[model samples]
Target: MKVKVLVAAIGVLAVMVLVGCGGGETSTTASTAASGSTETTAAETATSAQPTKASITVGVLVPQTGFAANYGPEAQQGIDMALAEMGVDSGVEVKIITADEDVLDASNTLERLKKMVETDGAQIVIGPVFGSSQQAVAPYLTQAKIPWFSFLGASKDLAGSGGTAFVWPGADQLTAGPLGDYAAKTLGYKKIATLAPDYAYGHDSITGATDTFTAAGGKVIQQQWVPLGTTDMLQYATKIDKNADALLMWLVPSDAASFVKEYRNLGVKIPLLMFLGIFDPTFQEVGDLLVGEIGLNEYNPNLDNARNTAFVQSYKAKYNAIPNQTTAFAYTVMENIIQGVQKSGGKTSVEDLRAAMNGMALDTVIGPATYSPDGIASSNRYIVKAAQAADKTYIWDPIETYENVGAPK
Candidate 1:
């Protein structure tokens, strides 16, 4: 999954998250939120008021029929894990309605979301998973007064005063800016070339790095944007600045596979700085091919924390495998919704829930989660290296962790 889970000729700005499905996507509670006050006291702010509703409905959006279709089942698995954890006796009844994110068509995304809210009575929703889809459906969420908890990632700018949008794991820029810094100051790259899908999430992911990279005294000599559904990379690959120290790339699953295959065949010797998803476990070729390369990671199932420990145990017990980034993002969103409803005494009104739990600290699979007044989120970001596991499968190996990071500087 692209954390941005993005691609398409859609306009910029996209969300559960707005940016990546797997890195090309977005999320937050794996750490702190807002100005960080919620980390220690979000629980204290919960109102002890009595129940206002016996049941709450949550709408979940996933891409079921596009290039990102594989991500749907993973998200569902995460949602199920959260539901099972919430169980049947948590006082508030949780009903779930499903819809396709439809990242390809903004209009379809809006239409489906409207049905979820207007007909199925979803009070809060998770996803509109791609950045473009999130952008397409956000205004509707605001007008309907429903909280949009992005399981993917979201733009900080979209989290305006409506208090209806809760962006987790910060935005694309927040996620990638650190890599910029690392590349400049740590990796000591002097110049770099970049390639990404020509869309909202791609721009944000690249800009996040270029901003920090430029600020840290590195030059981005060439930047290439690929259109959606363009899997053939010969035209783009031939033009890469061979003189640049490295090439940074981000793309949807299929396109990423296509481009890497082309890049390898060309025998380009430039070191690579990949955005997330280049090594997604789902794509065995890219992961195995990129082994030993460095990249940004939104989630690593191996995160060491009691909450994560328990989360991994439960997920493994159920799925017999580790939850990937997309699954973790969905699980975190579901956990937030469940906790918010429980803490606010089953109050599911859009405004009531936002007021009751905005910036509330959550121990999510990602980490501790919190929100800004404008709904921007905070969490952990990781710098990881691609490595092969014992079974010959590829996995992200965390080399460094950035805790409680909010938007980029």
Candidate 2:
């Protein structure tokens, strides 16, 4: 997998658009301006470091327009939040140069990433969120000898390739696999109908669920694949088998919202199991209808651990919105890079950073995370429910936690 999965659209379009960190045509050079927080202390002190460099340039490849647009800004926010916590103003200056990760035409990503590495001098590059975008650009990342990290995740297909790593809770199948098991063993869902956008990520995620679902004695009576970028979900919704135990769906953001409207309009009441669908931005629009529904998530804002508490508080204070998985992962990947630099005594070479980061355990917003040599992350996953909170605000309440979750063997 190349910066393989887990974009905001990793669930819907954010799941599809996801997020990446390569450079592109329309660019913004910026940095974090927020005050210090404990996360800054955590990232810096998480590993031993010498602030050797005054500044480092990071190139971001995220789609600024089209299906994945909802994810890019938040991902940048995550990077900024992490940089601030690492003391951007007070210490190391991290420069951000953004490029559009054109999900439509991936060649654009490769061309722009070249500028990021060659012309702009991005020492550590962040994205190219979609799997196809990552695949198009992987050769250059290796050729340039730039040690890159996925703000989202790279897929399992890119595993063990040089100059890269996948953030576990990454690979789409890994993140959703437990949900398949959960649907069978915990929820006692015996038969279900599945729906997802027809794409690599969509196929991989639903497979993650159904593969385990079937193994545990569940049957998927029907499977639907909506063409990527199709917004008319009513047609797909109308075709679902109402008698199945539940409907499992993963669409891009717009498509997901459209699907919900049609699902409700049709009074399709079989219940729902979604991949990160009932969360923010999405929840902000469809929360009222999704109450009591189940979804799979890579990050939950309600986590109570010290690391997550600090991350959520600091992030909310800075951005005034609950940090979604995109933001959280962006923050975590930045920490991974910064810490690698620190561990290697400020070496920016990919060879050095990769050696430093791989297998170096650290507390992340999503809990314990460590990168394997192949660049796959071993992290955690969540089974969440959309619940109306006391404040009448909608939140993805984590009902279960699966530790050290990674790609299924």
Q: For residues 16-126, could you state the per-residue lDDT of candidate 1 as single tens digits?
A: 223333332211211112113321122222222323245677777777655777666777777766766554445555666676666666676677778778976888888
**How high is the lDDT of residue 60 in model 2?**
72
Error of 2 at 344 (Å): 1.8
Candidate 2 achieves a global lDDT of: 0.73
Predicted model with the maximum TM-score: 2
CA shift at 165, candidate 1, in angstroms? 1.2
Give the clash count for model 2.
Answer: 43
Best candidate (score: lDDT):
2
In order, the Cα lDDT scores of the candidates are: 0.72, 0.73
Model 1: ten consecutive residues of lowest lDDT? 26-35
TM-score of each: 0.83, 0.84
Error of 2 at 19 (Å): 18
Off by more than 4 A, model 2: 1-51, 88-93, 277-279, 407-409
Looking at candidate 2, what is the lDDT of residue 177? 83
lDDT of 2 at 243: 78
